[model samples]
Target: MYSQQVIDHFNNPRNQGRMENPDGVGKVGNPVCGDVMYIYIKVKDDVIQDISWETMGCAAAIATSSMISELAKGKTLDEAEKITRGDVADALQGLPSVKMHCSNLAADGLRKAIEDYRNRRGMA
Candidate 1:
Protein backbone atom coordinates (compact mmCIF):
# COMPACT_ATOMS: atom_id res chain seq x y z
CA MET A 1 0.00 0.00 0.00
CA TYR A 2 1.07 3.58 -0.66
CA SER A 3 1.21 6.40 1.85
CA GLN A 4 -0.93 9.48 1.60
CA GLN A 5 1.99 11.52 0.37
CA VAL A 6 2.66 8.96 -2.27
CA ILE A 7 -0.99 8.90 -3.25
CA ASP A 8 -1.12 12.67 -3.41
CA HIS A 9 1.97 12.90 -5.55
CA PHE A 10 0.83 10.11 -7.80
CA ASN A 11 -2.57 11.68 -8.28
CA ASN A 12 -1.22 15.19 -8.74
CA PRO A 13 2.37 14.86 -9.74
CA ARG A 14 4.39 18.06 -9.77
CA ASN A 15 7.00 19.11 -12.32
CA GLN A 16 5.64 16.55 -14.70
CA GLY A 17 6.75 18.12 -17.95
CA ARG A 18 9.64 18.65 -20.29
CA MET A 19 11.92 21.65 -20.28
CA GLU A 20 12.80 23.67 -23.33
CA ASN A 21 16.47 24.57 -23.73
CA PRO A 22 17.34 22.98 -20.45
CA ASP A 23 20.86 23.40 -19.20
CA GLY A 24 20.97 19.67 -18.47
CA VAL A 25 18.91 16.56 -19.05
CA GLY A 26 19.16 13.07 -17.58
CA LYS A 27 17.36 9.93 -18.54
CA VAL A 28 17.42 6.60 -16.72
CA GLY A 29 15.48 3.39 -16.96
CA ASN A 30 14.99 0.27 -14.85
CA PRO A 31 14.72 -2.78 -17.02
CA VAL A 32 13.35 -4.83 -14.18
CA CYS A 33 10.31 -2.62 -13.86
CA GLY A 34 10.35 -0.99 -17.24
CA ASP A 35 10.39 2.36 -15.50
CA VAL A 36 11.98 5.29 -17.28
CA MET A 37 12.63 8.72 -15.83
CA TYR A 38 13.83 11.91 -17.44
CA ILE A 39 14.90 14.93 -15.42
CA TYR A 40 15.66 18.39 -16.75
CA ILE A 41 17.29 21.23 -14.91
CA LYS A 42 18.17 24.86 -15.45
CA VAL A 43 20.96 26.32 -13.37
CA LYS A 44 21.89 29.89 -12.54
CA ASP A 45 24.94 30.80 -10.48
CA ASP A 46 25.37 27.12 -9.62
CA VAL A 47 21.87 26.94 -8.18
CA ILE A 48 19.03 24.96 -9.59
CA GLN A 49 16.73 27.63 -10.93
CA ASP A 50 14.17 25.23 -12.31
CA ILE A 51 13.53 21.51 -12.55
CA SER A 52 11.06 19.15 -14.20
CA TRP A 53 10.59 15.54 -15.10
CA GLU A 54 8.84 13.00 -17.30
CA THR A 55 8.35 9.44 -16.06
CA MET A 56 6.89 6.21 -17.33
CA GLY A 57 6.34 3.75 -14.55
CA CYS A 58 4.12 2.91 -11.60
CA ALA A 59 2.72 5.30 -9.05
CA ALA A 60 5.87 5.13 -6.95
CA ALA A 61 8.02 6.19 -9.90
CA ILE A 62 5.79 9.15 -10.67
CA ALA A 63 5.68 10.18 -7.03
CA THR A 64 9.41 9.84 -6.59
CA SER A 65 10.09 11.89 -9.69
CA SER A 66 7.77 14.62 -8.45
CA MET A 67 9.42 14.62 -5.04
CA ILE A 68 12.95 14.86 -6.48
CA SER A 69 12.08 17.97 -8.46
CA GLU A 70 10.67 19.60 -5.35
CA LEU A 71 13.70 18.61 -3.29
CA ALA A 72 16.23 19.82 -5.85
CA LYS A 73 14.68 23.03 -7.10
CA GLY A 74 16.38 26.17 -5.82
CA LYS A 75 19.19 24.12 -4.31
CA THR A 76 22.83 24.60 -5.20
CA LEU A 77 24.36 21.87 -7.31
CA ASP A 78 26.32 20.52 -4.35
CA GLU A 79 23.25 20.47 -2.12
CA ALA A 80 21.11 18.84 -4.72
CA GLU A 81 23.76 16.26 -5.45
CA LYS A 82 23.64 15.24 -1.81
CA ILE A 83 19.98 14.31 -1.99
CA THR A 84 19.91 10.57 -1.54
CA ARG A 85 17.40 7.83 -2.23
CA GLY A 86 16.67 7.60 1.47
CA ASP A 87 15.88 11.31 1.56
CA VAL A 88 13.41 10.97 -1.25
CA ALA A 89 11.73 7.96 0.34
CA ASP A 90 11.50 9.79 3.62
CA ALA A 91 10.03 12.81 1.90
CA LEU A 92 7.28 10.58 0.59
CA GLN A 93 6.78 9.10 4.07
CA GLY A 94 8.45 5.98 2.73
CA LEU A 95 7.70 3.81 -0.26
CA PRO A 96 6.80 0.15 -0.40
CA SER A 97 9.71 -2.21 -0.03
CA VAL A 98 9.23 -3.52 -3.53
CA LYS A 99 8.96 -0.03 -4.93
CA MET A 100 11.98 1.45 -3.17
CA HIS A 101 14.06 1.17 -6.31
CA CYS A 102 11.90 3.87 -7.85
CA SER A 103 13.42 6.34 -5.43
CA ASN A 104 16.88 5.33 -6.56
CA LEU A 105 15.99 6.15 -10.13
CA ALA A 106 14.68 9.53 -9.10
CA ALA A 107 17.80 10.46 -7.17
CA ASP A 108 20.08 9.08 -9.87
CA GLY A 109 18.21 11.05 -12.52
CA LEU A 110 18.75 14.30 -10.63
CA ARG A 111 22.44 13.63 -10.04
CA LYS A 112 22.86 12.73 -13.67
CA ALA A 113 21.32 16.03 -14.73
CA ILE A 114 23.63 18.00 -12.48
CA GLU A 115 26.59 16.06 -13.80
CA ASP A 116 25.45 16.74 -17.33
CA TYR A 117 25.25 20.45 -16.60
CA ARG A 118 28.72 20.45 -15.10
CA ASN A 119 30.17 18.50 -17.98
CA ARG A 120 28.59 20.78 -20.55
CA ARG A 121 29.96 23.82 -18.77
CA GLY A 122 33.42 22.21 -18.63
CA MET A 123 33.27 21.99 -14.88
CA ALA A 124 33.82 18.23 -14.93
Candidate 2:
Protein backbone atom coordinates (compact mmCIF):
# COMPACT_ATOMS: atom_id res chain seq x y z
CA MET A 1 0.00 0.00 0.00
CA TYR A 2 1.10 3.55 -0.69
CA SER A 3 1.21 6.34 1.86
CA GLN A 4 -0.99 9.40 1.51
CA GLN A 5 2.07 11.57 0.76
CA VAL A 6 3.16 9.13 -1.89
CA ILE A 7 -0.26 9.23 -3.50
CA ASP A 8 -0.29 12.99 -3.39
CA HIS A 9 3.09 13.27 -5.07
CA PHE A 10 2.36 10.64 -7.69
CA ASN A 11 -0.92 12.34 -8.57
CA ASN A 12 0.56 15.82 -8.61
CA PRO A 13 4.32 15.63 -8.95
CA ARG A 14 6.30 18.77 -8.28
CA ASN A 15 8.93 20.17 -10.64
CA GLN A 16 8.33 17.45 -13.15
CA GLY A 17 10.01 18.71 -16.30
CA ARG A 18 13.34 19.41 -17.95
CA MET A 19 15.16 22.67 -17.76
CA GLU A 20 16.10 24.71 -20.81
CA ASN A 21 19.72 24.85 -19.62
CA PRO A 22 20.49 22.84 -16.59
CA ASP A 23 23.71 23.40 -14.69
CA GLY A 24 23.73 19.71 -13.98
CA VAL A 25 21.80 16.62 -15.01
CA GLY A 26 21.72 13.07 -13.66
CA LYS A 27 20.18 10.03 -15.23
CA VAL A 28 19.61 6.80 -13.30
CA GLY A 29 17.68 3.69 -14.09
CA ASN A 30 16.71 0.34 -12.69
CA PRO A 31 16.91 -2.27 -15.42
CA VAL A 32 15.09 -4.70 -13.21
CA CYS A 33 12.01 -2.49 -13.06
CA GLY A 34 12.49 -0.51 -16.27
CA ASP A 35 12.36 2.70 -14.33
CA VAL A 36 14.44 5.66 -15.44
CA MET A 37 14.79 9.02 -13.78
CA TYR A 38 16.38 12.27 -14.88
CA ILE A 39 17.14 14.95 -12.34
CA TYR A 40 18.05 18.47 -13.43
CA ILE A 41 19.44 21.26 -11.33
CA LYS A 42 20.46 24.87 -11.80
CA VAL A 43 23.08 26.31 -9.50
CA LYS A 44 23.72 29.85 -8.43
CA ASP A 45 26.44 30.83 -5.97
CA ASP A 46 26.99 27.24 -4.99
CA VAL A 47 23.31 26.70 -4.25
CA ILE A 48 20.67 24.82 -6.12
CA GLN A 49 18.56 27.65 -7.46
CA ASP A 50 16.20 25.33 -9.26
CA ILE A 51 15.46 21.63 -9.51
CA SER A 52 13.24 19.36 -11.60
CA TRP A 53 12.84 15.81 -12.77
CA GLU A 54 11.48 13.45 -15.40
CA THR A 55 10.60 9.98 -14.16
CA MET A 56 9.40 6.94 -15.99
CA GLY A 57 8.27 4.36 -13.49
CA CYS A 58 5.57 3.36 -11.10
CA ALA A 59 3.87 5.56 -8.53
CA ALA A 60 6.64 5.05 -5.97
CA ALA A 61 9.37 6.08 -8.39
CA ILE A 62 7.53 9.18 -9.49
CA ALA A 63 6.68 10.15 -5.93
CA THR A 64 10.26 9.63 -4.75
CA SER A 65 11.55 11.78 -7.57
CA SER A 66 9.14 14.57 -6.66
CA MET A 67 10.04 14.44 -2.99
CA ILE A 68 13.75 14.65 -3.77
CA SER A 69 13.30 17.85 -5.71
CA GLU A 70 11.67 19.40 -2.68
CA LEU A 71 14.48 18.19 -0.46
CA ALA A 72 17.29 19.41 -2.69
CA LYS A 73 16.09 22.73 -3.98
CA GLY A 74 17.64 25.80 -2.38
CA LYS A 75 20.29 23.58 -0.79
CA THR A 76 23.97 23.84 -1.46
CA LEU A 77 25.53 21.20 -3.65
CA ASP A 78 27.31 19.72 -0.64
CA GLU A 79 24.09 19.64 1.36
CA ALA A 80 21.98 18.27 -1.45
CA GLU A 81 24.54 15.60 -2.19
CA LYS A 82 24.04 14.24 1.30
CA ILE A 83 20.35 13.49 0.82
CA THR A 84 19.87 9.76 1.30
CA ARG A 85 17.30 7.13 0.45
CA GLY A 86 16.14 7.29 4.05
CA ASP A 87 15.59 11.02 3.67
CA VAL A 88 13.30 10.64 0.70
CA ALA A 89 11.48 7.72 2.22
CA ASP A 90 11.04 9.55 5.49
CA ALA A 91 9.78 12.60 3.69
CA LEU A 92 7.16 10.50 1.96
CA GLN A 93 6.17 8.80 5.21
CA GLY A 94 7.88 5.61 4.07
CA LEU A 95 7.44 3.71 0.85
CA PRO A 96 6.42 0.11 0.56
CA SER A 97 9.36 -2.24 1.23
CA VAL A 98 9.27 -3.67 -2.25
CA LYS A 99 9.41 -0.20 -3.75
CA MET A 100 12.17 1.17 -1.51
CA HIS A 101 14.70 1.03 -4.29
CA CYS A 102 12.82 3.96 -5.82
CA SER A 103 14.08 6.14 -2.99
CA ASN A 104 17.71 5.14 -3.68
CA LEU A 105 17.40 6.22 -7.27
CA ALA A 106 15.96 9.56 -6.28
CA ALA A 107 18.71 10.29 -3.78
CA ASP A 108 21.46 9.06 -6.08
CA GLY A 109 20.07 11.15 -8.91
CA LEU A 110 20.35 14.28 -6.81
CA ARG A 111 23.90 13.51 -5.69
CA LYS A 112 24.91 12.64 -9.22
CA ALA A 113 23.55 15.94 -10.41
CA ILE A 114 25.67 17.74 -7.87
CA GLU A 115 28.70 15.76 -8.96
CA ASP A 116 28.03 16.65 -12.56
CA TYR A 117 27.79 20.30 -11.64
CA ARG A 118 31.05 20.20 -9.76
CA ASN A 119 32.73 18.36 -12.59
CA ARG A 120 31.58 20.88 -15.14
CA ARG A 121 32.80 23.75 -12.97
CA GLY A 122 36.15 22.10 -12.23
CA MET A 123 35.40 22.13 -8.54
CA ALA A 124 36.81 19.42 -6.36
Candidate 3:
Protein backbone atom coordinates (compact mmCIF):
# COMPACT_ATOMS: atom_id res chain seq x y z
CA MET A 1 0.00 0.00 0.00
CA TYR A 2 1.18 3.51 -0.80
CA SER A 3 0.95 6.46 1.52
CA GLN A 4 -1.17 9.47 0.72
CA GLN A 5 1.94 11.57 0.19
CA VAL A 6 3.30 9.02 -2.20
CA ILE A 7 0.04 8.96 -4.10
CA ASP A 8 0.00 12.72 -4.31
CA HIS A 9 3.54 12.89 -5.64
CA PHE A 10 2.96 10.10 -8.08
CA ASN A 11 -0.26 11.62 -9.34
CA ASN A 12 1.27 15.01 -9.82
CA PRO A 13 5.00 14.75 -9.95
CA ARG A 14 6.91 17.96 -9.43
CA ASN A 15 9.72 19.13 -11.70
CA GLN A 16 9.52 16.12 -13.94
CA GLY A 17 11.20 17.07 -17.17
CA ARG A 18 14.46 17.64 -18.94
CA MET A 19 16.28 20.78 -17.97
CA GLU A 20 17.83 23.27 -20.36
CA ASN A 21 21.62 23.42 -20.10
CA PRO A 22 21.78 21.67 -16.77
CA ASP A 23 24.96 22.34 -14.84
CA GLY A 24 25.01 18.68 -13.87
CA VAL A 25 23.21 15.44 -14.59
CA GLY A 26 22.95 11.95 -13.11
CA LYS A 27 21.60 8.77 -14.54
CA VAL A 28 20.75 5.67 -12.52
CA GLY A 29 18.81 2.49 -13.07
CA ASN A 30 17.74 -0.70 -11.34
CA PRO A 31 18.09 -3.53 -13.78
CA VAL A 32 15.81 -5.76 -11.76
CA CYS A 33 13.00 -3.24 -11.52
CA GLY A 34 13.66 -1.52 -14.81
CA ASP A 35 13.40 1.83 -13.11
CA VAL A 36 15.71 4.39 -14.65
CA MET A 37 16.08 8.00 -13.61
CA TYR A 38 17.89 11.00 -14.96
CA ILE A 39 18.30 13.89 -12.55
CA TYR A 40 19.29 17.37 -13.68
CA ILE A 41 20.22 20.46 -11.79
CA LYS A 42 21.08 24.11 -12.39
CA VAL A 43 23.37 25.73 -9.90
CA LYS A 44 24.11 29.35 -9.09
CA ASP A 45 26.58 30.59 -6.50
CA ASP A 46 26.97 27.08 -5.04
CA VAL A 47 23.24 26.70 -4.59
CA ILE A 48 20.78 24.58 -6.44
CA GLN A 49 18.74 27.05 -8.38
CA ASP A 50 16.57 24.47 -10.04
CA ILE A 51 16.09 20.74 -10.21
CA SER A 52 14.16 18.22 -12.28
CA TRP A 53 13.98 14.60 -13.27
CA GLU A 54 12.96 12.27 -16.06
CA THR A 55 12.11 8.81 -14.82
CA MET A 56 11.00 5.52 -16.28
CA GLY A 57 9.61 3.73 -13.29
CA CYS A 58 6.69 2.70 -11.16
CA ALA A 59 4.71 4.80 -8.70
CA ALA A 60 7.30 4.54 -5.94
CA ALA A 61 10.18 5.47 -8.21
CA ILE A 62 8.22 8.32 -9.74
CA ALA A 63 7.24 9.68 -6.33
CA THR A 64 10.80 9.44 -5.04
CA SER A 65 12.06 11.32 -8.09
CA SER A 66 9.46 14.00 -7.54
CA MET A 67 10.29 14.25 -3.83
CA ILE A 68 14.03 14.61 -4.44
CA SER A 69 13.46 17.45 -6.89
CA GLU A 70 11.46 19.28 -4.27
CA LEU A 71 14.08 18.58 -1.61
CA ALA A 72 17.07 19.70 -3.65
CA LYS A 73 15.83 22.99 -5.03
CA GLY A 74 17.18 26.11 -3.41
CA LYS A 75 19.62 24.09 -1.30
CA THR A 76 23.34 24.69 -1.28
CA LEU A 77 25.45 21.91 -2.71
CA ASP A 78 26.47 20.72 0.74
CA GLU A 79 22.92 20.69 2.04
CA ALA A 80 21.66 18.82 -0.95
CA GLU A 81 24.38 16.24 -0.55
CA LYS A 82 23.16 15.56 2.96
CA ILE A 83 19.72 14.53 1.80
CA THR A 84 19.47 10.82 2.30
CA ARG A 85 17.27 7.95 1.20
CA GLY A 86 15.60 8.15 4.59
CA ASP A 87 14.88 11.81 4.00
CA VAL A 88 13.10 11.12 0.76
CA ALA A 89 11.16 8.27 2.31
CA ASP A 90 10.25 10.35 5.33
CA ALA A 91 9.17 13.23 3.13
CA LEU A 92 6.91 10.84 1.30
CA GLN A 93 5.54 9.49 4.61
CA GLY A 94 7.42 6.24 4.08
CA LEU A 95 7.49 3.63 1.37
CA PRO A 96 6.78 -0.08 1.38
CA SER A 97 9.71 -2.21 2.46
CA VAL A 98 10.03 -3.71 -0.98
CA LYS A 99 10.06 -0.29 -2.62
CA MET A 100 12.67 1.25 -0.32
CA HIS A 101 15.30 0.86 -3.00
CA CYS A 102 13.41 3.39 -5.05
CA SER A 103 14.27 6.02 -2.49
CA ASN A 104 17.86 4.83 -2.47
CA LEU A 105 18.11 5.31 -6.20
CA ALA A 106 16.58 8.76 -5.92
CA ALA A 107 19.10 9.86 -3.35
CA ASP A 108 21.96 8.32 -5.25
CA GLY A 109 20.88 10.09 -8.42
CA LEU A 110 20.85 13.46 -6.73
CA ARG A 111 24.23 12.81 -5.12
CA LYS A 112 25.60 11.77 -8.46
CA ALA A 113 24.36 14.99 -10.01
CA ILE A 114 26.11 17.00 -7.35
CA GLU A 115 29.26 14.99 -7.85
CA ASP A 116 29.05 15.62 -11.56
CA TYR A 117 28.61 19.31 -10.93
CA ARG A 118 31.59 19.39 -8.63
CA ASN A 119 33.66 17.33 -10.99
CA ARG A 120 32.95 19.68 -13.84
CA ARG A 121 34.08 22.58 -11.70
CA GLY A 122 37.24 20.74 -10.54
CA MET A 123 35.80 20.82 -7.05
CA ALA A 124 35.42 17.10 -6.64
Candidate 4:
Protein backbone atom coordinates (compact mmCIF):
# COMPACT_ATOMS: atom_id res chain seq x y z
CA MET A 1 0.00 0.00 0.00
CA TYR A 2 1.29 3.46 -0.92
CA SER A 3 0.55 6.76 0.76
CA GLN A 4 -1.03 9.73 -1.01
CA GLN A 5 2.31 11.47 -1.18
CA VAL A 6 3.91 8.36 -2.59
CA ILE A 7 1.26 7.97 -5.24
CA ASP A 8 1.47 11.62 -6.12
CA HIS A 9 5.21 11.43 -6.47
CA PHE A 10 5.05 8.25 -8.54
CA ASN A 11 2.43 9.69 -10.84
CA ASN A 12 4.39 12.89 -11.35
CA PRO A 13 7.87 12.55 -10.00
CA ARG A 14 10.30 15.45 -9.96
CA ASN A 15 13.77 15.30 -11.40
CA GLN A 16 12.77 12.10 -13.09
CA GLY A 17 15.26 12.02 -15.92
CA ARG A 18 18.98 11.69 -16.50
CA MET A 19 21.58 14.42 -16.61
CA GLU A 20 23.44 14.79 -19.90
CA ASN A 21 26.85 15.07 -18.27
CA PRO A 22 26.61 14.77 -14.55
CA ASP A 23 29.44 15.55 -12.19
CA GLY A 24 28.68 12.34 -10.34
CA VAL A 25 26.52 9.27 -10.76
CA GLY A 26 25.55 6.22 -8.70
CA LYS A 27 23.54 3.09 -9.27
CA VAL A 28 21.98 0.71 -6.74
CA GLY A 29 19.47 -2.06 -6.86
CA ASN A 30 18.05 -5.26 -5.47
CA PRO A 31 18.04 -7.83 -8.22
CA VAL A 32 15.59 -10.07 -6.42
CA CYS A 33 13.03 -7.28 -6.30
CA GLY A 34 13.95 -5.78 -9.65
CA ASP A 35 14.38 -2.40 -8.02
CA VAL A 36 17.10 -0.19 -9.37
CA MET A 37 17.92 3.49 -8.70
CA TYR A 38 20.35 5.77 -10.41
CA ILE A 39 21.21 9.22 -9.14
CA TYR A 40 23.05 11.98 -10.92
CA ILE A 41 24.41 15.18 -9.47
CA LYS A 42 25.83 18.38 -10.84
CA VAL A 43 28.04 19.99 -8.28
CA LYS A 44 29.65 23.38 -8.10
CA ASP A 45 31.95 24.60 -5.38
CA ASP A 46 31.25 21.56 -3.21
CA VAL A 47 27.52 22.23 -3.42
CA ILE A 48 24.93 20.12 -5.18
CA GLN A 49 23.51 22.64 -7.61
CA ASP A 50 21.30 20.03 -9.20
CA ILE A 51 20.24 16.40 -8.67
CA SER A 52 18.19 13.91 -10.63
CA TRP A 53 17.21 10.26 -10.67
CA GLU A 54 15.84 7.43 -12.82
CA THR A 55 14.44 4.31 -11.27
CA MET A 56 12.75 1.07 -12.15
CA GLY A 57 10.73 -0.10 -9.19
CA CYS A 58 7.48 0.43 -7.29
CA ALA A 59 5.72 3.56 -6.07
CA ALA A 60 7.92 3.85 -3.01
CA ALA A 61 11.03 3.85 -5.16
CA ILE A 62 9.64 6.60 -7.34
CA ALA A 63 8.65 8.68 -4.33
CA THR A 64 11.95 8.20 -2.59
CA SER A 65 13.86 9.22 -5.69
CA SER A 66 11.80 12.36 -6.02
CA MET A 67 12.21 13.27 -2.37
CA ILE A 68 15.92 12.55 -2.47
CA SER A 69 16.33 14.86 -5.43
CA GLU A 70 14.50 17.61 -3.60
CA LEU A 71 16.58 17.12 -0.49
CA ALA A 72 19.92 17.04 -2.26
CA LYS A 73 19.49 20.06 -4.47
CA GLY A 74 21.17 23.25 -3.32
CA LYS A 75 22.80 21.35 -0.48
CA THR A 76 26.49 21.30 0.13
CA LEU A 77 28.36 18.01 -0.01
CA ASP A 78 28.35 17.87 3.78
CA GLU A 79 24.64 18.53 3.90
CA ALA A 80 23.86 15.97 1.24
CA GLU A 81 25.96 13.43 3.06
CA LYS A 82 23.68 13.76 6.07
CA ILE A 83 20.59 12.75 4.15
CA THR A 84 19.24 9.45 5.43
CA ARG A 85 16.58 6.89 4.53
CA GLY A 86 14.51 8.08 7.47
CA ASP A 87 14.55 11.58 6.01
CA VAL A 88 13.38 10.26 2.66
CA ALA A 89 10.60 8.23 4.23
CA ASP A 90 9.53 11.15 6.41
CA ALA A 91 9.46 13.37 3.37
CA LEU A 92 6.94 11.05 1.85
CA GLN A 93 5.05 10.99 5.14
CA GLY A 94 5.89 7.28 5.36
CA LEU A 95 5.96 4.02 3.45
CA PRO A 96 4.71 0.52 3.93
CA SER A 97 7.01 -1.77 5.85
CA VAL A 98 7.74 -3.86 2.78
CA LYS A 99 8.62 -0.78 0.77
CA MET A 100 10.95 0.73 3.33
CA HIS A 101 13.83 -0.83 1.48
CA CYS A 102 13.04 1.40 -1.48
CA SER A 103 13.70 4.46 0.64
CA ASN A 104 16.92 2.90 1.81
CA LEU A 105 17.95 2.28 -1.77
CA ALA A 106 17.27 5.88 -2.72
CA ALA A 107 19.49 7.15 0.07
CA ASP A 108 22.14 4.67 -0.94
CA GLY A 109 22.03 5.91 -4.51
CA LEU A 110 22.46 9.54 -3.49
CA ARG A 111 25.17 8.87 -0.95
CA LYS A 112 27.08 6.70 -3.40
CA ALA A 113 26.86 9.43 -6.00
CA ILE A 114 28.25 11.96 -3.57
CA GLU A 115 31.04 9.60 -2.67
CA ASP A 116 31.83 9.11 -6.33
CA TYR A 117 32.07 12.87 -6.72
CA ARG A 118 34.32 13.17 -3.73
CA ASN A 119 36.58 10.47 -5.02
CA ARG A 120 36.75 12.00 -8.47
CA ARG A 121 37.71 15.31 -6.94
CA GLY A 122 40.35 13.67 -4.77
CA MET A 123 38.40 14.68 -1.69
CA ALA A 124 38.17 11.09 -0.51
- How many clashes in each candidate? 0, 0, 0, 0
How does each model score on TM-score?
Answer: 0.95, 0.95, 0.95, 0.94
* lDDT (10s digit) by residue, model 2, range 46-95: 99999999999889989999999999989988888889999999999999
Assess candidate 4 and give its TM-score to the true structure: 0.94
Q: Write the per-residue lDDT of candidate 4 for residues 41-78, one digit (tens) a residue.
A: 99999899999999988778888999899988999989
For model 3, residues 6-78, the per-residue Cα lDDT tens digits are 9999999999999999999999986676799999999999999999999998899999999999999999999
Displacement of residue 107 (Cα, Å) in model 4 is 0.8
TM accuracy, model 2: 0.95
Comparison by TM-score, 2 against 3, better one: 3
**Global lDDT scores for all candidate models:** 0.92, 0.90, 0.92, 0.88
Off by over 4 Å in 1: none
TM-score of 3: 0.95
Report the error of model 1 at residue 71, Å.
Answer: 0.6
User: What C-alpha lDDT, on a 0 to 100 scale, does residue 69 get in candidate 1?
Assistant: 93
Q: Residue 103's C-alpha lDDT in candidate 2?
A: 41
Q: In lDDT terms, how accurate is model 2?
A: 0.90
Q: Weakest 10 consecutive residues, lDDT, candidate 4?
A: 98-107
The C-alpha local distance difference test score for the whole of candidate 3 amounts to 0.92
